[model samples]
Target: MGKTYLYLLIAVAFEVFGTSCLQASQQLTRLWPSLGIVVGFGGAFFFFMQVLKELPLGITYALWSGLGIILVSISGWVVFGQKLDLAALLGIALIIAGIAVINLFSISSPH
Candidate 1:
């Protein structure tokens, strides 16, 4: 159980890192950044796949997708200065609640 969440965290970190490099790749107009994007996304996906191997599919996907949403929203605000309106904030909150529910009450998990 701990190991599964650790892998999920790694996947989220890779995804966040990859997303942060989006601007660099967008502006560089070179081959290196493109390659980096490819490899970064590939690595992130690999971690995500590994996460799914030991967890229930529904719970795993929910957590993965929810974490991605929350982190990406934070990244946008931090890196892009995008304001989160009340509605947007609420939406993110809902996603977080959904993840918490899965963690606390999911009967299907091996944990």
Candidate 2:
């Protein structure tokens, strides 16, 4: 169970890295960034599959995508000079709260 969460964390990291590289890819026109996208997303999916082995699909995807959204949003702001309005910030906060609720209370979560 602990290993499953570790894998999920890794998967989220890889996915965030892939999404950042996707921006650097310039719509897939560059070579290295494009390769990063391929490798990063591939690694993310691989680790995500490992996570699914121990956790329910719904729970796994929720954690995976939720964390991904938060991290990727921050990455965009920092790395890409993107702006988040108040509404967007509130949405992000809500997502964080949702993830916390799932981790703390969901029965489907791995212990």
Q: Put down candidate 1 lDDT per residue, 1-111, tens digits, no spaces.
A: 688789989888777767666755776586776676677677889989998889877877778778988888888799878789999999999998888777788787666
- The deviation in Å at residue 108 for candidate 1 is 1.9
TM-score of each: 0.85, 0.97
Query: Residues 1-111, candidate 2, lDDT per residue (tens digit)?
Result: 788999999999999999999999999999999999999999999999998889999999999999999999999999999999999999999999999999999877855
Alpha-carbon local distance difference test for all models: 0.80, 0.94
Runs with alpha carbons beyond 4 Å of true place in candidate 2? none
Lowest-lDDT window of 10 residues in candidate 1?
Answer: 19-28
